[model samples]
Target: MTENTQHDVIRRNPLLEAAQEEMRKFERRENEFRRKDREERAAELQLPLAEIKVH
Candidate 1:
């Protein structure tokens, strides 16, 4: 077998495939959550509150 074929076999391992898929899912969720939090913080900061009126 050639060197390229050997490398392809290793890349096709089931355990490696599962681990890579899990990492992809985790990264996607992390990015989504971070983006949402950033948007919320930006919105909060943009709000204008002139004075605090206590009753």
Candidate 2:
């Protein structure tokens, strides 16, 4: 393929960029529920919060 054709094929057009942003937003929303802090996990599991904090 010509250089211009190859470049065109690989270009990040607006639609593709918008689609990618939407996917990122969806992933972040899903991860918000999937990911939990230590306190949240303890509360969910009905366990006492530990006094020690681990980084």
lDDT agreement with native, every candidate: 0.77, 0.76
Give the runs in model 2 whose Cα sits over 4 Å from its true position. Answer: 1-12, 36-42, 48-55
Stretches of model 1 off by over 4 angstroms after superposition = 1-12, 47-55
Give the winner by TM-score.
Answer: 1
Candidate 1 lands at a TM-score of 0.61
Which tens-of-lDDT digit does each residue in 1-55 have in candidate 1? 6999988888789778899999999999999998677667757887433352312
Clashing pairs in 2: none
**lDDT tens digits, residue span 1-55, model 2:** 6999978867858679989999999999877766566668878888755665644
Worst 10 residues of 1 by lDDT: 46-55
